[model samples]
Target: MNLTITLVFLVLTSTVRSLNILGIFPYHGTSHFLVFRVYLRELANRGHNVTVISHFPEKNPPANYQDISLAGTIEVLKDDMPVEKSYTSIINTALFLTFTGKENCEVMVKNKQVQDLVHSKAKFDVVVVEQFNSDCAFGIAYKLKAPVVGMMSHILMPWHYQRLGIPYNTAYVPFHFLEGGTKPSLYQRVERVLFDVYFRTLYYFVTQRSDQNTLARYFDEIPPLDQLAGEMKFLLVYHNFILTGSRLFPANVIEVGGYHVSKAKPLNGTLKKFVDEAKHGVIYISFGSVISPSSLSHERVKAILEVVSELPQRFIWKWNNKTLLKAQDKLYTDSWLPQVDILGHPNTLAFFSHAGMGGTTEAIHFGVPIVAMPVLGDQPANGAAIEESGLGVQVQIRDLNKENLLAAFRKVLDVKFRERVKQVSKAWHDRPMPPLDTAIYWTEFAARHTNFTFRTAAADVPLYQHFYLDVICVFSIFVVILVGAIRLSLRVCRSKSPGKASEKKQSKKSKRA
Candidate 1:
């Protein structure tokens, strides 16, 4: 009996070993950070010591969770992001991320709290860093001497393809910022190629170079930023094949797309009564946490308001200034709303969203159809996918008129659209394992197999070698030489032929005469 008890104790202890994990997410975007918070909290819940570095620290803490807050860093993104698609808008966003990313990195490394952690004898078993606009966190993970795991809150960036060996077939895979699904027209394919080249070049020459300069200020021995990125043990991408389309991924690239979405908590207060008692169901309208509704032009706001007034469905608009939209009996406006609970509610009919990845995933999870008005970044592609997948319709912000807005709502509210969305939601939830478990397992997998080789050799190969351009050059030279030799031989044979010789002599004699 004592031996049996001892064996059981051993088994229990072995199954749940506590690990020291560190997560570094320096970007100040709240929506982006929310996607990662779920995994960090779960790590703490699973008896691991998890420390996170970010601006939005938890108000309440669990025993094993801690935060090293970089709360004072300048907010990288604001309401300045344009609400329309244009060449100027694209350039503005690229330049913004490039320069502001450097500023954020500089501020993070210089912080007193961050410096203390860096200088201390901190021993983390594994480090997870957000693989977004900046890669300066990789240097910190190296300083801690821990295996690194990269977590992407949305679709992979343009530059990530070559380094990670993920194929970027421009013919099918639409650029993140463009508005076409997998089956794009010829014009969109051409646009995708140009955008891909532009972003990749900008990231490599400007963004990575700037980040490396910032890293050199603090860590003298850190490798190049791209090299450290290529060294990551695993890449937890917040995308699924159902939405992003089935694409190839390296062994280390794990898709835990919908992990951040949790079971909706019961709504309470005025919000609960508002959603529960809506006679014709509710339309949840939010532009997400980044873009403030106040930044919207008065014309756009008026258009939205006019359309909502016409609809019989009650509106729950997430507006920053509740006074901006005059309160009507049918409309409920708040600065903050329980978005997930509202979407999960049966009374919720359609979602009017900016099509940010987090909100789009939640809408899909709750089987709520979306009326997407994409503004910037990956939203255009995501919005297009929503329309292509039959999950809903997309209304471009450039065309945010009452006519278009109402049409989009009518399309999403159709019975067939809702039923199709339910089917997609069912498929999305039908994963082999829950997304949270998949994330935790891979994160632990990285820690446990620290010595294992997860990066592909393609990461180290030069572009020319990877694509066999040199071999193509050599083959071209051989073909040229072979063609030249055949032409020379034919000329020689014609010169030496009896008929040709007779004809040449006759021509010479006639010229002499």
Candidate 2:
């Protein structure tokens, strides 16, 4: 295909509507960039021009986005996301969580460097950005003379704002566990509830006080809450596949499960040889970004490998931080594996993963049953979803020993596991287009049509509107106090009535004297 022609085809897609996107991912990581990188690539390939601002250059990005000096790709490294820190870890979550939504939103506006990028404002048709980086992202959007489109890489869809009353970056998704499957533990539910409550309070404060700083700076006067658009205004575009078990999203929200089908290079020969030679199929295991494979108890690690080594199946393990380690001949060790290629192989029957969204999506997409050892975030819930759907089994990291590992592996290799996988995989693949294409189509739709309709709205509605507590409970308490006070005064008056006659007589006597 002629490169120029591809650009025209991609760009002409916007004849009905053209969107110049300010695509921003705060830091570079598998989760942060993978789906978005593909989504942007499609836009550039389709002929729509993309100006992606990221921390680093993506290798072999679709079309020469950065080198496309002519009508090609315009990729820019924003130098914001640090390369070393971008590696996956749970430790980063606390930092990400600590940044108040408002402060984060304000950071982008205040930063001179980020602001300078926005200084040369492009009258973009639309802005696609992550919701997490509300700090700089919305600031970038504010500079654009176009509508903003918010994209979430996580499973939490924006329509959940209306559907479940969850706000952007406020709280985690409520896991609706499967029958006889792992549900959110009591602790998880409480933590979510507490976090939800905190955001709920924070949102109220932000809404109520939004205009104070704006008015103080602009007019030397404090303005009312209603005047604040800085905190209130923005639209959401999310990446969700229905396979994750979500429903009734608003028309305004888009579901682009776009990461599923990438043009990422396939697996190579040394990897393929291990898969092909393993007559009993392969057990591929890797914990995603944050937790180091070295963190695993050496005993647990050896036990898992020892058991798998004994199994009839072949094994390919993805281990990071194994630089000084020696591996048995039956085992394969690498910091990374070409996951898609391995999953595509017929002999690759199962994936032992940390249950990251990216990995889970791939596993389901290829119809490979999973043996999950979920450690953080919504991994537990996701793992539960997989198990509940009858597609796989999830063992807690703490429970991952020789026996459990073998048990989970045996369950996945069973004929039933393969059958269940085919059912879901068919559903996943048979969709009208790849999840990514759907995401693009919906993103385009969201871009062209600015009126984002939500499934239901809980943002504007307060707790009184939701639980009716203030209306019913508070008012009832007020009425009880009022009635009690009135009765107390009446009783006092009655007691004083007897003294009134004597007091009047004494007053008359004093007057006569």
Candidate 3:
């Protein structure tokens, strides 16, 4: 009996051996950090030791998790490039993120604590890096001699899939930032191709070179960024088919869309009272973390407030400013609110959002329809997808007015929209396992299997060959040769006919003579 007990203990211990994981997420954006934090917390809960380097560190972390602060990065961004005025276009956003990402990477790698951890005898089994504007974090993986995994906050971009040798067919998969319905028109498809090419070129020449220089600055011997990217064993993408639509994904790519979403906590006293008193239901309004509603021009803010105040439903707006606008008794404003809990409330009718992926996913999770006011980046695409799903109506910020806002509210509040959202909520929750479990399982699986065999040969193929431009060139040459041969044969036949006619004329002349 003692021998059997000892054997059982041995097996259990082998099954749950703890792993050391290092996560590098140096971006200063709160939403980005939140997404990474979800997975880090999950890993810690599963008995893995997790160390995270992020811009926003947790005040009191769990026992198994450690947080390294990069708060200074935020101050640098605020001083150099103001959030409200910086990201106007796709190009501008890319440039801003690229520069800031590199700067943050340098700051983290050069920190005394981080440098000590790197040079110490401490070892990690795996390194997970956020694949945004920074590729410098890959140096940590190289230093520890550990396999690397990439974490993405939104849908996979062209460069993300291309690194895994996945086909980036722009004809079918629209660019992540483009705003269009499921069925793209001819012009829209052309525009998608152009946008894809433009961004891919920009990343390759500008962002990629910058990443290489940053990596070189830290590590004495490191592989090129492209080669290191291709060597990644797994990618955890924060997207799902419910909103993004179904598409082919490579074996190494895993979708954990709502991993961060959890059961709604009870609202605070003030919020609970306000929500319970709303007999006619509530319309929750928020523009998400980065873009404050108060940052809008006075005219725009006034227009929005006027429209919401006239609605029959009680309004709960997330206004960051201390001053409050005059409104009816039913209208309420707060500096911050528990968004997910409010969305899950039975009294919540519709959500006014910037249509960010995190907010959009939460609204879908709770069966709340949306009034999308997309500002920039992937917000427009998310808004378009929400509208295409028949669960929301999009209102452009520049075109905001009383009539348009009222129409959008009425459209999204219709019973059909509510029913559609419920259907989607059901489908979104029907996965075989919870998203967090799926993420943890894949992350551990990657740690165990350092080498991935599922990568496609397309990664090694030249660009010209991957797109079949060489085949087109060869086909064009063959067609030219065939046409020339046909023309030559026709000329020979005509010459023969003239020679035969002349011979016949000579014979006739001889006969006449």
- On TM-score, the leading prediction is 1
* TM value for model 2: 0.72
lDDT of 1 at 112: 80
lDDT of each: 0.85, 0.58, 0.78
- Which lDDT tens digits does candidate 1 get at residues 349-372? 999999999999999999999999
The ten-residue window of minimal lDDT in model 2 covers 67-76
Q: For candidate 1, what is the TM-score?
A: 0.91
After superposition, which runs of candidate 2 have C-alpha atoms over 4 Å from their true positions? 1-18, 59-92, 99-113, 133-135, 157-188, 198-242, 263-266, 322-328, 451-457, 469-513
- Superposed by TM-score, candidate 3 places the C-alpha of residue 269 at a distance from the truth, in angstroms, of 1.5
The sequence of per-residue lDDT tens digits that candidate 2 reaches over residues 75-146 is: 222212211221143334333443433443343334354455566665666667765423345444554545
Better of 1 and 3 by TM-score: 1
Which portions of model 1 show Cα errors greater than 4 Å? 1-16, 75-81, 495-513
Q: What are the per-model C-alpha RMSD values against the true structure? A: 4.4, 8.8, 5.0
Ranking by TM-score: 1, 3, 2
